[model samples]
Target chain A: MNAILECKGLTKSYGGKKALSDVNLTIERGRIVGLLGPNGSGKTTLIKLANALLTPTSGEIRIAGMKPGTGTKKIVSYLPERNYLNDWMRVHDIIGLFRDFYGDFRPDKAYDMLKRLNINPNDKLKTMSKGTKEKVQLILVMSREAELYLLDEPIGGVDPAARDYILETIISNYNPEATIIISTHLISDVEKILDHVIFIREGQVVLSSSVDEIREQGKSVDGLFREVFRC
Target chain B: MLGKLLKYELKATGRTFMPIYAAMLIAAAVTKLISALTAGGSEVPEFISAIVYIMILMGMFVMTFVVMIQRFHKNLLSDEGYLMFTLPVEPWQHIVSKLLISVLWNLGSLVAAFLSIVILTFDEIANRALMLDLFAVIAEFLTIFGPTGSLVVLEIFLAGIATTVFGILLIYASIALGHLSNRHRTMASLGAFLGLTAFAQILFACLTLIPNVRVLQHYMDTLQESLQTSIALFHYVMWFTIGFFTLLSAGYFLITNHILKKRLNLE
Candidate 1:
């Protein structure tokens, strides 16, 4: 009941094909959890359900005791897998949007990050490169001081060096009182940062355990993930 | 929150629309300049100006509808839907912000078109004559229908607004339905639109038939009285349809909200 995120018997299907089924999970506050899975294995699906981007076919998902709704939306900082900012918007305009909509959003923090990254506030999103767009999205997502952060594929599109920078950003901006659920396939890159890892495949969790426990078992989360979801 | 959403929505959509609006006004100005330069000779510039003027008017009309759909689908149902629906605002507020701004822009477009026309044909004597003629006709209309005619005008205006809302809601509901599809979303939306239009046509036809054939059958016997009575009945029917449309728009809004809130399957 005290968990920041709870999903009970959550199922999502599209046109009779099940993307996720009978997902029962709980994420406690103040931990960076890795939601690791192969492509099309429902990592994004669960994250989307938590963010209310997609609704459950049955059962329910609750973030902070409330159902996925405008209320939960207020406290859930979501970085969708796609580039969601309007192309016409300037970098600062979107930053302003997050600030205006979310009371927890810190504009000063956002500006600092953008300035450090050398992204001009006046540049339109369409003018930025693909990698740069992802960075901007990350900045916007990290600037919010929310109770729950749902990041779907946060580092998927970036290069190796950019991925490190993004990880650094997530680490530095990590809110100890807030839970962070990061869904990504690059398990090794995030393994060191993850306190816990949920191994999901074929729309169900095969393993949910602490990173220490996995390491003590003489296997990295990445190795176990390969073993668990091997083709 | 709704105000903030409106501000952002307007800012996002204005970039697309303002340029077109400015082009329309510029076209109007260019047409006037061409007329002045031509000075009633060399018909080529005038002919080209007329085409440009007509094209700008048509472009504005078409762009208005395009911007409306883009605002709803691109902002709320496309990839950007990720950002939009995640905002701490309710779905109803989303609808209201878009609807209120849409109505405002619709009126703005109308005013812009009017101003463009006035600019294009701004000869003082002719405009004065035109205004006088328009007022004289309205005065005569008021004289015949008296207080009832005023009521009719008000009802017609209300009905016009209702129809615009109904059209927007239909598009919105269709877009919501289309989002339920996994692929070919544009085609799906078009199909939804056509399906709704078919249903609406049948409903309105039934409404028109029931009154004209059955309800007003008695008044058909008197030729002169039927004219006035028909006008009166038409007035009543306008109000009735307007009420029906309002309910339909509300229903569409509820459907759209349900899709966004509960059945949302964003791609």
Candidate 2:
């Protein structure tokens, strides 16, 4: 496999409950992979493992042929589900922080994104609406010219217009030599832009295939999701 | 990268600390001004003025601990951890950044506290003899404890600095350990902190009782009234305090690093 992301017997658990279990997967570079799963279907667990936010139970995860640490963190840009920006800092301060830490961060590009969305650079995060804060986070993550992007629920909690903008931002900003793994519940909204899709269910990988392959089977990705994970 | 982390750490803390320090200094000046203006008119209650000064110092002291705890918890264990740990820096950089900034602020508050007291309470008219009064104080201590008393005093002062830094790192280590909990993290941290403090205090208290009381008793029984003996005892006590806290500081630093690197559960 020409993989940019790889997991071997990867397992993670909290207490006695398994979040992910004995899973092996790989995603090639230069593709937008949608990590589709139910709310507690281990999608975020897998992503967090990749980000080094959570340690595994029994196995290993590798990104870009290296373990997750200072080295891999250099090339992996992560957009967490929660609002992680410090409320007291101005928008520009966060951009400065990104610039300071990530060598791949493009401040000009981030500024352009911020201006396009009408966010004031000098505004504190507490002054911004929740939607604006989410947009700012997306802008920072997307501005990084990293080898891997792990965005967890990127389009959630935003208006449709902003949602469209975020999706378009993801599409237009895709680097042919890099990989993007977006984990979200709004599969239909993101399916059109996704090049590959993986469906996880209850700590197991139920399906992993390309979007074209799902279409060749005469089924929309969203349709297959509902069929696979119905209540 | 370490420099950048330190810069941001300072920036993050300076905003709140600077304002508090300025307000305390201003309040001290205002109290002095009121006392100066009322020197001849009517008696301003000394107790009330004393309270104002003490309260400012106490607030600064308490907030030193509070702010350090909050900064470590909120910055490294809360949602902000997602931003921090993802940065292209080793986890130790984060710990060191917090440690250095915390020590800087702790020492800064102490200096500010001392200066505020001097500014508020010093009387210029009596200040004409302040130099002689200082020498008189030195001579008094010297007669009681001898020449090495000065060295012991210096060592004690240095020990105070080490103790503060070590105590702060103990809190950091406790909080790092508490971060292992998915629920009750705050409570866990508080318990760890109190437990560690009690452990260190008990350990140090036992060590103190072993020699301080016994040595003095032995000196008295032997009828050896040499000032040099007292000076030697003073030096040993000061160095012991300094060495003990330095050891605590190193131990806490290692434990904090271990938990942060191996058992990190930033929920």
Candidate 3:
């Protein structure tokens, strides 16, 4: 079977500045890979490329043996860092949107998640707090039975308690046979759940190894991240 | 997928349009009532209501234009783009869905405006006769060409639709071109629109300068010579106009789609 994602000499540049350069990597299936990086470290760019939001400047990247496109989008459930929901829609209306577009979306799963979070189905997004909106977004993303889940900064802006809930939701809800590439800077928070860690700095992959390998070498992923990315 | 995209597009844009249409009808009803109650007395309320009705009719069109621009920009090119572009649909489906919905709302507002006017004058026998006479004149005008007249009328109606689609696609293309720039996107869009408009006008002007393309005017000049030839020329011109706009709309569609697919910059 093909790796869940593969990149060959993938490079992306904005104007003259390269966001990602010569990025050659592969991510296998069924692993919770932490794509650890700092701000503006091309983590979002890489995620955006995989989602087909932005075209790569050169080379190519593939998802499950197919290029990033409608086919790839079908199986990759993405949770962008920004609030992408419109203010005019209610929670249920958004669920309906997901149901209309994503064949793999589980509306029952989405409603259950919303119920557990105490988010009313009829509540308008405009009235919801930022944290509540983020939770709702996360719930919608996690409810998809997708083959690959690309979550960009899933815990970046939430409080510690909500962060824990988000993490727990991510752990409990995702498809076990699928892969999850979480792009985040909060290393300590997500370190425990991650089976593999890929350290990216200055738009280049610095380290790609399993968490067990790092632990065997007597270093936590967080400690290694601090050493590699300290300014 | 296009059908689903259009369904959501309608729902999203209808929220802004439906209320205004209802307001227009209500204002028309109030105007009629105020004029009826104060037939020979105070005209102030009637005047105010009439003005309100007119303002709403004008506002509906303005809002239609604003919503068209906003739907394309905000829904497809802003932060919401993350959700939209990631859907398992092609970029052209997004453009076509938005275009279809925008055209639907445009036609809906026109129908509502005409309905509101009819409501304001429904009770007046003179106004009813005037409208019937207008329709009779149009009917008589169509019956002149016999069977060909209906086809001519259909062509004209299609030309109207083609023109509307062309205008919307032009705007889409401008916005897409503007988005390629990293800074001053709105300004770039406006510039692109103005630039495209001027180029089209100049191209048409240059086309008219060619003697071969002056067949439209030649047909008009020879109208007294033969009615049959004039009708044929009319059909030719209408088809040419329809085809011209459809081709242009296709060009604009391709430009917009290419930009959205490969050159998208949703920063």
Best by DockQ: 1
* Model 3 agreement with the true structure over B1-267: per-residue lDDT tens digits: 999999999999889999999999999999998998999998999999999999999999999999999999999999999999989999999999999999999899989998998888877635678778889999998887779888977898899999999999999999999998878999999999998788767765665557445686777677787777777877877887898788888988999999998887678
Candidate 3: clashing residue pairs, number: 0
- Residue range A1-231, candidate 3, lDDT tens digits: 789999999999988999999999999999999999889889999999999988899989999999988999999999998999999999999999999999999999999988888899999999999889999999999999999999999998889988998899899987679999999988999999999999888889999999999999999999999998878
TM-score of chain A of 3: 0.98
lDDT of 2 at B158: 85
lDDT score for residue B166 of model 3: 91
Which consecutive 10 residues in model 2 chain A have the weakest lDDT in total? A1-10
Fraction of native Cα contacts reproduced by each candidate: 0.96, 0.80, 0.81
- Rank order (by DockQ, best first): 1, 3, 2
* Top-down TM-score ranking: 3, 1, 2
Q: What stretches of model 2 exceed 4 Å from their correct place?
A: B43-54, B139-150, B205-225
RMSD of each: 1.9, 2.5, 1.7
Off by over 4 Å in 3: B125-132, B211-226
lDDT against the true structure, per candidate, is 0.87, 0.87, 0.91
**DockQ of each model vs. true complex:** 0.84, 0.80, 0.82
- The list of candidate 1 runs beyond 4 A from truth reads B124-130, B211-214, B222-231
Cα lDDT tens digits for candidate 2, A1-231: 457899999999898899999999999999999999989999888988888888888899999889888889999999999999998999999999999989999999999989988899999999988889999999999999999999999999899998998999988886889899999999889999999999999999999999999999999999999999888
DockQ computed for model 3 against the true two-chain complex using alpha carbons: 0.82
